[model samples]
Target: MVGIVIVSHSSKIAEGVKEVALQMAKNHPVYTAGGTADGGIGTDPVRIQEAIEAANTGDGVVVLADLGSAVMSVGLAKEMIDPALAKSVKLANAPLVEGAIAATVEASMGSPLAKVLQTAHDARNMDKVE
Candidate 1:
């Protein structure tokens, strides 16, 4: 099963997104990396790296981040982790909440990494109003 990581400047936001993703797929692994070590509103590369490692389960890990800095942190975190694990981690270019939910659903179905990533990216085209 693929894993998931949610990154946000606020710990609450990251945890909230994880909560929502879990509701859709309780059996899947979803970790969060949000805020600074001191509980401030900032992204931390080390925290993101730890979350990535924790979320991974030999399959792969998908990361959804809110804001640019969070995304950058994800990149830095990837560099800090093992090369093999870094290769298995993907960063989705989709809205954090929607992407996490869609990816979780796809991964819960035993979908491969590429499919899960595609599902997350596809969420960008969702027509919420229609």
Candidate 2:
């Protein structure tokens, strides 16, 4: 199954998203890289890269981040990871919570990397108020 990584400025947010996503992807790898190395409100390349490494299980990893710096951090983390592993990782441009849950569900269904990524992106169009 494709793994998932959640990157957020707040650890609580990342962990919360991970907790929810895990409910649907019980057997898949789901990791969180939130806050700075010192546990502040920022993103860390090292931390994100480590999360990516932990999430990787040969299938690949999809990363969802909150806001700008978190997104940039995931990008930097990708460059820091091993080249082969980096190739298998993708930084998804989707809402953090919804994307994580959607991606996790799709992944749990045995979908491929592309399909999982697409599912997460598709969540952006969901009508939550409807």
Taking all chains together, each candidate's TM-score versus the true structure is 0.97, 0.96
**How many residue pairs clash in each candidate at the backbone level?**
0, 0
For this target, which candidate reaches the highest lDDT against the unseen true structure? 1
In order, the Cα lDDT scores of the candidates are: 0.94, 0.91
In model 1, the clashing pairs are none
lDDT of 1 by residue, 19-75 (tens): 988899997889999899999999999999999999899999999999998988999
Query: How far is 77's C-alpha from truth in model 2 (Å)?
Result: 0.7
Weakest lDDT window of 10 consecutive positions for candidate 1: 25-34
Question: What lDDT does candidate 1 reach at residue 56?
Answer: 91
lDDT of 2: 0.91
